[model samples]
Every structure is written in structure tokens, then in C-alpha cells.
Target: MANLAAVVGIGQTKYTTKRGDVSIAGLVREAAANALEDAGLGWDDIEAVIIGKAPDMFEGVIMPEIYLTDALGCNGKPMLRVHTAGSVGGSTALVAASHVQSGTFKRVLTVAFEKQSESNAMWALSTPQPFSVHLNAGAGGYFAPIIREYMRRSEAPYDVGIKVAVKDRLHGARNPLAHLQKPDITLQEVEESFMLWDPLRFLEACPSSDGACAMVIASEDLAEQSPKPPAWIRGVAMRSEPTMYAGREEVSPQAGRDCAADVYQQAGITDPRRDLDCAEVYVPFSWYEPMWLENLGFAAEGEGWKLTMEGATSLDEGGDIPWNPSGGVLCSNPIGASGMIRFAEAARQVRGDAGAHQVEGAKLALGHAYGGGAQFFSMWVVGSEKS
Candidate 1:
């Protein structure tokens, strides 16, 4: 009693460090309106609304969905909110797809945003929690040791991270909505930048941006009537583990591996590297490009770094399976919206809607996001042809 779901519309705001011109509600409304326009539909066409964001403490606004409904024209429609730390965006999109796939709704709107301009995410992240002792200062501090361990196990060169930073930034330069436009960023510059953590440089980390991303998901019948070609949802999966657990593998978390395996199986992908034309993975830190490359089965365990060094993931480098052609989180990170942006970008690629960063002949794509000590994992597969 389930049906197919497809993304009929995708929208994103111009990511930046601050958006002083609009309130948080206004920011989300802008993205929602854009998505509605892209779908060639009006507010009444949507039957439900799902919104997501990081902690309200990040913005000092509690229960934002109550007020956001009005801005989204969801006054009388069913509205829901989902949260999973940084993976919230991807999870939100999956939830919206579920409503359509379950045959409970014909169409739904999903949006995720983060107004980091008014919120101090770093401060909130660094705060101490009751059960966990956070010896690491910030995200970088926590992930640095894990990255170092991967380097030791893989024996990757020291410049592999630098190469990834430059590659993603170069990809970001092609995206007009990216926050940090460094088309000319060099590996030497990244290598020389100040080291925030033991192995992560200032340039190798993602920027805290203020923006939102929205998507319109519709059932098979509604999607067939869309004005634009639909990116058919092939599969979706989510998995989570405790924040800190004994004998946990932080470098390549089991949750992430299992989630990818589940989604790929649903999509009938026996080899992610061969089946997917491109990918938009969550790589907040530069080293994560290689780490996730392995975790996602793009490469063999210790050989993921070799793919990066060979420019296999670079769009401008004429790589076959380009990753993050839209610049990715390294270029613009709207916290709660980052993962949705990745999912949307993958859809854009499959629909042949990605402009300058378009992966040629991209009929299949993968979008992935992870959070909370790499314990939370969400992934989806999309294709031009419905599965």
C-alpha cells in the first residue's frame, strides 16, 4: 500500500555568514516560496509541511514550527518538525518523502534552515553535557583525533586533506549560492593556514552560514504531472548510535556504513562507485572527504585517500564520479540546512538541473549526511528514472 515519491522542486537561499535583512521566519519563507515557484504550484497545492533545524538554543527560539507554519502557508495543513543534530536536514527530507510514499499524502513541502548569524553554534556546541565529558573544545577538536587515526591507518599523505579543501572550494566557486567563493584557493594556502585543531586547518573547515533549503516531494501521479523532470526517490535510510560508547569506531562509524548499505540495497546498487554518477556527502572538515569516501563504499578502506590525491572526486578535474559538484558544506554550512542542500543538489544533478556544476549524463546520484560524533547517519539515492 505504498507508492513512489519524487522530488518535484528544490530551492536554496544564497548562503552567507549573516542575513541581517530577514528574520529566521522570513529566511525560511524565502526558500519555501522559491521551491513553490520552482514546482509551478501555489501554497494550496501542498497538503503537508515538514520543517527541521538544529537545537532551538542555537537560535534562542523555542518551537519554531508553531510560528513557521504561518510563514509557510501551513496554517491549516499538517505540520511536523524533525531533528537529528546535523543530520536533521537529510532526515527531514526523508520524513517528507515517507508521507508521499506511504500513500498518506499526495504532496508535501520540506524545509530546513539555520540562522547562524543570530546564534552562536560554536558556543552551544562547546557547552558541557551531563552524561558526556567533552574534552574536545569544538567539532574540529573532537574530530581531529579521529582524523589522525585514519591517517595513521591509511598512511595517507599529509597534503591529502589540503588537496580535498582546494578541490571542494574550487567546486564551490562554480556555485553562485556558495558562501565562500575561492575559485583560486590553492593547496599551499590551505597548508599554510592556521591550524584550528591538531590536523585541521582554518581553510579546511566548513563555514557557519545563514540560509535555508527546501524541497517539494510528491507521489508518483503528482510527480508525473510536474512541469520539470522529477528526481525519483530510489531509496532512503537513517541510522543512529549513542554519542559515546565503548569500543566505538569513530573514524568510520558502523551506523554510517550500515545506513549506506541499506540505502544502496534498496536502490539496487551493488557498487556505489559504479552505480552513482555523483555524490554530495557531508564533509564539514576537509579530511572527511576521504574518510566518507571510504565509509560510503566509494573506495576500499585504506585507498579512499588515493582517490582524493588522484582528483577522482573533483568536477573540474574531469573525474567520472565527481563529489560535491556544488561546492558542498566546505563552502556553505547552514547547520540544519546543510544536509538538505546535499540531498537537493543530488536531485539537481539527476534532473540535469545543476547549471555550471552539472555532472554530465548524471542519471543516478547519492546524498549523505552524518552528525553527532559521526553516530547519526542518513542517506538517500535518487535517479532520473523511477525505481
Candidate 2:
């Protein structure tokens, strides 16, 4: 088996709807430099670079990573580009960690991003594909049915979605790097927002953000030499199934459950709600907060909504098992970089480096991501102390 790897540095750009000031290369470089600075190291210290994103078409530039090699300081260094839809960010980080865990590289840099301002996401998603009819209008259109099914089966209250949206947007207010920091937002405001899809409002959907997130992973030996404390990787896993398979449950995806189980077993977690200090889950739609709760084994089937209703997922008093303290995907959706942001945020909490959103004395954290009809799943567990 390979040796354990730890995150020595984490960095992300200020997320926004349109970062027209910088080119894609410039945007990635900004995040890479911040990570290097946080590690108290320089580009000369990096051994390899791994870049990931949803699709090249999103940025209107094919194989943009090739042109960004120089910007990421990958000149003459081994470089790899990964694409697995929205899970690309988390998978990219895992690939970089593997290199260090294998003892093949002392230090590795991983980065993920999206320049959604260059194109409209609705058009990109609705674009016609060969032999397939474009039935759904956009992501909201595709997911609305699943959300409706969840509501029907669970008999959840109509206000549950609105509550989740309010909570995440409130949490986003605490994160300076978040794209939408609506501090004064209220539940009533979310309910009053325009409905984008049935049971999904305009505020419930994630914004098309232009941003990048980067991290530096190193072997145990190299981690001990780093200036900042490292967040040790306990377990990592990725799983995929057909986008639309027979007997598939889109509302509560089995792929997510299997992915979580694999990681939990590897990390020796028997009960996620009690074992995990905090979680950074992919919540592009607010309702996912509860859906993922059951899928991740935090609650029994049909009981995920109880956690949200009782405020157990909040960061405030009387709440436990806080989720998305970094405002999560609802605050920023760079698509390609979204998943890595979750992983990086979890690492930050464990490293005791999460600025204002830091969970007090956080020791263990879960980072999760899913994409493509909820068929692709990637997850990782990180802890403050080496496992």
C-alpha cells in the first residue's frame, strides 16, 4: 500500500459571476500562487501539476491546461489534466494525493477552475447532443423532478427547501471568498424568490461562478518540514455508474452511498454524524443538503429532512454535524472547481486555517462531490492528526 499524504497548503480565488479582468491562465495562477505562499514555499518546490475541469467547451478553449502549464509553474514538470464532469475537481485532488502517497513525488500541486462568464451555462447544458433529445431546459429542470420525487416519498414539508437555502446563504456571509454573501437574507426572502423550477427558487440554484481552487499535497516526510500544519488524508474514494440505469433512484443515489461507505470504511468511521467534525458537501441545490444526509448514512432513509428541520446542520448553537460552513456550492459554483473547493475547505478546517468559517477544534472532516445525474461520486476524509 502507498504511504499517507497530507495537504500542506490550500488557496482559492474570490468567487464571482464574471471575473473579466483576468484570462483563464491568470485566474489559475492567482490560486496557485496563494497555495504556494500558504505553504511558505516557491514554485521550485513543486514536483508535478494536475489540472481539472468539467469540460473544455465551458471555457470555449479546448485543452486550456496545456496553455496554462507555464502559468501554473509546470514548465518541464509532469502535468496531467482530468475531466469527469463536476467531480473532476475532487478526482483531480485525489490523483495528486496518490502521487505523493505512492512516494513518487515529494510535493504536488492540484488546481481546478471554470470561467462560466465566457459562456451561458443554460445554453451549454441544453445544447443538443447526438441521438438524445434535450428534454430538460437546464440543471434546475433536470433536478426538479428528482426533488419532487424526494418530496413525495418522504412527505417533506414544502418549506424545507427554503430553509436550507436560507441557512447556506447565511453561512456564505461568513466566507469572504464566497461569491454570494447575503448576510441579511431570511427564510421569507428565499420563499418569496422567483421559482426557477418546481420546489426550486432562483436563490436555491447555484450561481455561475468564475473562480479556481488549488491545493498542495505532500508525503508525510515532506509534510513534517512544512511551515503550516498539514491535514492528513485518511481515506479517498471515487465511484461511477450509468447515468440512467434501471432501478436507479435519482433522489437518493446509490452511488453516493457506496462512495461514502467505501471512504468511511477506509477511514474507520462507523457513524458519520458523530465521527465527523464538519462536512463540505456539494449542495448546488439546497434540497441536496437533506438528500445527501440520508445517502451519506448520516440519517436513515426519509429522515434526512428531520436534520434540516431541527437545525442540526446549522453552524449555530444547538446544532451539531455542521455542513458547508464555507457557504458551499450554493454560494459559488465554478462547476469544475466546485468539488475541489469542498475538499480544500475541509482540509482548511482540519489545518486550523479556515479564516472566519473555521469550526472550533475541528479534528475530522468529510469532503464530498457528485455529478452527471448523480451517478459520479468522489469523497475524502481528512483529519488534523496523521492517521
Candidate 3:
């Protein structure tokens, strides 16, 4: 219903455990600069900026975008900060794209980042709020129960999680920008890793990395004139529900399903696994691959693990769908930037610029992100050609 929008540039900082060399502003600028270079444009070409992250407490800085405007080249331009828990990155990009899609801006810049080294994520996640039970443990503690429920409901083997860990780690090795490049990763090693939660091992959890991801989106006309091939945004959608509500299924949230359905409808995808050449899903935990596979309609409920077991997610398997060729969140998770990385990776596949992690002959790709007790979801479908 709005003017078509396409991604002309994508950039990301090298992921690391600690980016002490640069301040948060500097980290974001590096990504923004790279995106501009890739777009064959300059800071002067950007009309506005959209920044996203999880929580201010994580960095001990409130309203960081205000101080970051200059670093992001947003002086004298409209700027917005998006925070939808973990899906903030994807939501931020979607908001920026809307400006282009509405014909309100020719080119817009969107950036997301997180310096987890600034603070312990476990402590940040466990901060107690009034009238809420304090769960002193970290994200693994919060999510392990949901995974346990999935295992029980689906009858998934215990080794399925280990398999996912091994696969994603191997995939991460191919992504030069990934934080964890465990080239020698093996299923035996994953199985032997120290258990963090009941069923989750340290290797199965996403790393708290310092990184940033950025993208330049433009209107259809502007994109057509760009030097680089544009990754046309076929569809974008976001959905949210209360963090905890009666009758809500935490493992397969309705928000994720509804968001996928809306985007798929706009993209004209009748069969996701068959139509989508690849996907970049937010999987901070290895188990989420199969859980999302089912939620995204790539496989029948209780059968998602079957795909993972069959090596259907591998790049060389010639499987119907390849997911997380960028190594995904399991390999590098800058909480604020994780979602944008997924979106950016999808764009890269469509732009034919994924380098070693590229899915062969990829034409259509899905990008997905979720946050906040799995209650928020953002997704986009991209293609090589204009729709």
C-alpha cells in the first residue's frame, strides 16, 4: 500500500566479546560508515536515522541515541529510538523502511548495537521489578523451562539440541564477522560442554558480543539508481502480545505465528520451506531452530526437530531451506543488533553478497526476530528482484 522500499547497503562491525577499543558511539559509527560506503553514498545523503536496542540499563545509559546523533550523522535530522526488548533491531529497521516506503525519505539509515561487555547480561536480565518474582539467574534460566516444555511436547531427543549447537557453530566458522568461529566444533564437544541450564550447555547459548549492524534503505526509484543490487523488501510485519498472559504458549507464541503469516501473505509465499531459499532467524539458543521451524510453518508441529536431525538446515545439503547461513544469534548476539544482523544477512543473500556463507542461487529469504519472553516478533521477506 506504500511506496516500495529496498535495501541498498548493509554493514556490521566485527563481533567480539569486548570492543573496549571503541565507545558505543564509535562502535555504531563504524557500522554506519561501512553501510554508507557500501551504498556508494555519504552521511550527507541520509535523511533520518533510527536506532534500536534492548534496555537502557544494559549500558547504564538512558536515551543513548540523544548523545549518539552526531556519531550517526543524524544532526538536524529526525531520529527515532526503538526498544521492543530483543526484537528492537528488526523493529527499528522496519520503521526506517516505512519512511522510505511512505515516500517520506529517499534514503534512511538504521542502526542497532549492544556492548554486553559494559555490563553482565545475567545481572541485567535478573533485575527485579516491583510485584514480580525475582529470577536471579540469567536468560538461560528464563528460557530453559520453555525449552523443556518443547522437548516434552514434541518428544524431541536430548541430542537434538546438541546437533543444533554443532551445526550453528560450524556455520559460524564460515562467517568472518561472526564472534565465535569455532572451526573445530564437534557434536562430541557440544555434548561434553558444561551445562548452563538443565538441558542447555554453555555452547548452546548465544554469546554476549560487542557488535553493531546497519543498513541503508531507499525508495524504489532511489534503489533503482543505486550501483549495488538492491534487496527488495517484499514484505515486513511485526506483532506483539503481553509478556505473560493466560493461555499463552511460550514455546510457540501466537505473535510469532501471526507475524510470519502476515509477511508470508504479502510475499505470496504459500509454502515457506519450499519458497524461501534461506532464512536468518534469531536463535540465541540452539533449540529455537526447530521451535521456530514449526512456528514459521516450515514444518508441522512436533516435527520441526526432524528437519534439523535430517541436516535440512545445512548449506550444502540442497535442502528445501537453509537457515542462519550467517551463523545466527547462537554465534554472535549483540542483543540490540542481533535482529538487524538477521535482516541484514537476508538482504545479503538476496544481493548476492553473502561471501562464503552465501546460499547458492538464493532468490527469496526470510528474516525473523523475537524478544521479550518470546512475546514480540518482527519479520521480513526479501527477494533479488523488485516485486
Q: What C-alpha lDDT values do all the predictions have?
A: 0.94, 0.91, 0.93
The residue-level lDDT of candidate 3 at 142 comes to 85
Report the lDDT of model 2 for residue 366. 98
Query: Where does the lowest 10-residue lDDT sum fall in candidate 3?
Result: 314-323
Tens-digit per-residue lDDT, 215-279, candidate 1: 99999999999999999999999999997889988889999999999999999999998999999
Q: Residue by residue across 158-237, what tens digits does model 3's lDDT show?
A: 99889888888888889999999998988889999999998999999999999999999999989999999999999999
Per-candidate Cα RMSD to the true structure, in Å, reads 1.0, 1.0, 0.9
By lDDT, the candidates rank as 1, 3, 2
> How does residue 138 of candidate 2 score in lDDT?
76
For candidate 2, what is the TM-score? 0.98
Every model's TM-score: 0.98, 0.98, 0.99
Candidate 1, residue 33: CA error in Å?
0.6
Q: For residue 183, what is the lDDT in candidate 2?
A: 94
Off by over 4 Å in 3: none
What is the lDDT, from 0 to 100, of the residue 336 in candidate 2? 95
Alpha-carbon deviation at 344 in model 1, angstroms: 0.3
Q: List, in order, the clash count of every candidate structure.
A: 0, 0, 0
Clashes of 3: 0
